[model samples]
Target: MKEGNAISDAHQVTAWPPIRNLVSDMLAISQRTHNGYGLLEFDVTTPLARIAEHKTRMPDGISFTAFLAYCLGHAIGEHPGVHACRQGGRLVVFDDVDISTLLEKTKPDGARVPVIYIVRAANRKSLAEINEEIRRAVRDDLYDDPAVRRRRRIVRMPALLRRGVWWWIRRDPVRRKRQWGTAVLSNVGSAIDARPSWGLVQSFLPCSVTVGGIFERVCWRNERAEPRKMMSVTVAVDHDIVDGVPGGRFVARFAELVEAAAGLDEEFGTSAGDRAEGQSR
Candidate 1:
């Protein structure tokens, strides 16, 4: 046979990072996790407008993701059962709403990787506080984070030992919270393309949220059709721990909060309607 051109085809095979195994381990745990997902769409025109205006005043720009995180925290606080993890015969529920999210960080070699960042006591934090925290994490060298360092060591172990470590961690709710978090919020849409879509994300946490894109859509208001900004979001909870009644309630309350721009009005003193009125004149 003549020499084939297959060898000339450009292809690069990169070594898989050990840390990816950590995510794989988490996905493996999800096999045993029974999750009920609520795919929701929220009218975020007010919040987006408010966030845009707030950015002009504050040096640290407001993040829509942070606002959603704030809303998720309070919502979980009201329905604590959604954040409860099952430990053998009993259920372990936590009051503090700890949200674990992945923020991209650049390594010294200039390779970008997602680093796990936990927003502790998210319920008690204000919008500005959450915004600044997220911004700071983006600026910081997250590879130096102690939690990331510890996780690096864990990923280096043999596959069996690594799996065993995760099992041991999951056995105790407190341990899981300390190591992973009580809940997870993955905002994949915000960081990626502008395509408006809902992401169905899987996680090992008791409660998880996947925030998608904001796109303009026609909505009926006062029997008149008007263009409004809509956001795609998904809220998931462990079905074994959280029932439908409470889960539905949590989604309702969360939608109401986001649609009404709950945290923004308290800080900004006006709604999108009010801002539009001033600009019109």
Candidate 2:
């Protein structure tokens, strides 16, 4: 941040406000409670192919976040227990499948900052609708995003008091369910380290899913070597809320829904280009 520092050095020295607030808030959530978590990675090659086809056929590129939310939403819908939290005497299962996810946007200073967004009732929305929502979340600058507002508000609070407020938000089941949601997803598909594999993360939530980079790999099908596009998906479930058996089942269900997504042309009738053209006229 010095007047003449090199770009890399300056970036290292500068702690962007938005990203700092995000980390601070996440730390508060981590401190709220402890949950036994396990990581499971799935080879989601089949559905990835379907997603690729859908992308090619659609005029407006679809957001991977939208596709993921659709798949995860349906899977959670079938197993509502995954989104439930235990109270003193009862379990509270939210009917809506709200998904909290991380997104990166360029700050006014030209540095990229990570922001959190929650897609409420994802199970109730179609793929097209989810796609539009994510597009709007990123593209529309007419209104401040919820994450931006929260970051602005939190940054104004004293550090000592901010953590307390965040802890309070996470501690309340109703508020947490509404704001942070039952399941969490982080998209790391774009940041592929040439390390030969994906990263596994155990988020402080009932369930957390991370989608890693998609790369071409050799596959041996019917004794023939062929190249196939494959991606890594890590799903972590709270052991207290979901046991291994159900956890495995949930992952399998998510994979099934992703692979089973069909008829992109029929699902999305209008192309993004067409919509834009109509708007311009």
List TM-scores for all candidates, in order: 0.89, 0.81
Which digits, one per residue and each the tens of the lDDT, describe model 2 over residues 1-281?
55575555334465455457657667556554445444434445665565576667555567877888988988998888777776657778888899988777776779776667788898888777777778777765623766558656876788778777776766677877765788988878768852235556645567778877776678788899987666667776766678778877777898777656522445454644354456469
Candidate achieving the largest TM-score: 1
For each of the candidates, give the backbone clash count. Answer: 0, 0
**lDDT tens digits, residue span 53-146, model 1:** 7767555557677888889888888888889888889988887999998888887898988889998889888766676678878888776787
In order, what lDDT does every prediction score? 0.82, 0.70
Off by over 4 Å in 2: 1-18, 31-48, 193-196, 262-265, 269-281
What TM-score number comes out for model 2? 0.81
